[model samples]
Target: MNMQRSMLAVLLASTIAMPAISAEQGGINAEQGITTAIPMPVANNAEADAQLSAEELAKQQAAEQAQKQLEAIIGASGLEGLGEQARNLAQQVLNETQAPLGFQYDVVDRLTPLWAPVALQNTLASALASLDDQQRELLQSTLNSRRLQNARSKELSAIADQDNRNYQDYISRLRQQPPAPARVALIKQLDEAMQFSALLSVTRSSVYPQLQAVLRNWQPPQDWQAGLQRDVTEFLLYVHRTTPNDELQRLAQAYREPVLQQWLAGVKKSLSRQAG
Candidate 1:
């Protein structure tokens, strides 16, 4: 039984640790791709409680959150009460899924600074290589414009500042208000929501749509645009495939629950506008 559990952990870890390629600006790094190993058994020594950097602590918390979400989905049929066997199964799955991720993190940490720049350069070059010479030159010229770059930077900063202010206000309100079931549920759903938001951003910023608008005059091959869309969709599907189908269905249902809908109303409207 112990050996079986160990094998399961290795399989899950390896499956989730492989990074799926994404075309958009933000792609998953090692940290976001998976998570830490099965936590070492807590020790009584002070060394066991060594301080972690804020970023490391945040990643640890995120891993914990993912564990809770996965457990919730797996135990959905009997979530109100878990028997010992169910609890054990959940732990076994969690350990297996995250163990390989720990090794991946170490490798990525060592190599990222050395290879990330080259990888990014290659990705950009590959994208540009698909365009006709005139089209590629046109984009290169626009990107080189200092005024346009500055304008975009200022615009993005303003948007980020407003978002920060809004978030702070939300947090302040939560502190002042009494606890409610809906509020608690919303808090629990945050990590999943953020993942969804990331997916939305990737789809929204996809090169296929940009090319559709920019290359309207160029009349790029019909098959070329379709291929780009297919590639982007496949990448997104790969990320989603990490979760079991039943778990994904449960997550979708939970998002539609009243508590999440209330919080997500504004986001839904914004997404709809983008779609339109």
Candidate 2:
């Protein structure tokens, strides 16, 4: 199946029977956002009959907190109310600006209150569900700080108000200047810390089984999963391309904080485990 179709299937599996939630998506955005959850994969133990293991309790609590946080972020974003308007606004922004190539502008337009699928939301939950309270707190605080940093970057960069030609010209010049190797390395670090790739991977893996269960004779392209991965990667690169370099740097720096690095390592590991 094509990636968009695959995305649609994930959303279908998530919300088909569930009540339509208010357009609360995940993440915080200073024109950006983040989200997480996980609960199911805790290994069973010898103490199963006695009481909840500490790990089990922590994971359960983390999942509950993740669900609550997800709700809060979604409500704050008011993404549901802006459904069609987001598309219009994104297009309008691109029309006014010297739009970046690919899907970057669309990403900037929609990053806030990200209108992601329910399955994707669940994938995030599953990712964070393994953390303890301390880790979860770190996630909220770190993401909130990143949100502020993004807002600050937008304010300081003033790219929003710059003349279109000059803005595009600046990007052209910046493109000519090869980025510092460290900066490139840092950007790659942010990419891993962000968890978008892992979420996409795990969500796709989770969705395929649902598709098989839902549809009879669900023959698909042999390389369908790879196609889905390629599409998602390219699309996210497009999003990354539109992001201001300075802002991207800030995101990288924010996530490089030790606490987040430690927490996200576990989350990424969990999601990857599911994907495999």
Candidate 3:
């Protein structure tokens, strides 16, 4: 019976091995067929290579044509004329689209009221003084838009040189004073003004250095370390926001006392924690 069982196991092993051997032989035959069949692809590959070459040549020709056209346009019309033509084409395309009602008309009407005559005359003179009739007409057409005229007027009206100088002088006087509550209040008022560019100029010219000096001489009160930390952090952030990064680094280096450094480190750690 043991010999019979051993024979049965051998029979089972042979059954599995026979299939594996047959599969291996079949795979080898399949591989040989694939290798023989691959040569058939060479014709297709040559056809594809020829097609790709034709496509590349077509693209190259198209690009050359486009470049030549651009050069011809530049030579004949000039860059400014080309730009004006492009703009007019774009506007025509935009006008044909049914996107919204009255939007373009509203924009044009809004701009017409603001046009400055003197500035427009000056601009036209500057643009057309050296040009021929055709070029002058082109420039006039470009600048003749009601919107352009209005924009020039608005720009001229917005700044009075005398008033601007006076305001800067006032700000300088305020900055020279001690950093009392009044000065801080004045700074806040200036900051709230709509003319932020002018305000910024005055702040950089006047207020910033004064604030820095105040910070340098500041003596923190007892039990005021926390408040000092907060103030310094706020001040640094203010500086960072108002001053450029290079200027901020210089200011930071100037204020790198032990207390200020400690405050800055705390601020950095707090920021990192918030970010995380």
Best candidate, TM-score-wise? 2
lDDT of each: 0.35, 0.45, 0.32
Tens digit of lDDT per residue, candidate 2, span 1-276? 111222222322324121222333232233323554443334443354235455556666665665677555333322222222223333333344444444432343233223234433444445455667676666666656746445434433442434457554654554577456665554555556554445445444543443334333553358855665544333333335557677777776775767556545654465456434
Instruction: List CA RMSD, all candidates.
Output: 26.1, 17.4, 33.9
lDDT, candidate 1, 83-175, per-residue tens: 121222323433444535544344333323212333322232333333444553344344334533443343334334433665346435544
For model 3, residues 65-128, the per-residue Cα lDDT tens digits are 5344323322222212211222232233234443233443432232222112222222222322
- Look at candidate 2 and tell me the lDDT of residue 270: 54
The weakest ten consecutive residues by lDDT in model 3 span: 16-25
Between candidates 2 and 3, the TM-score winner:
2
Using TM-score as the yardstick, the better of models 1 and 2 is 2
Which regions of candidate 2 deviate over 4 angstroms?
1-134, 146-189, 214-216, 242-246, 258-276
Worst 10 residues of 1 by lDDT: 77-86
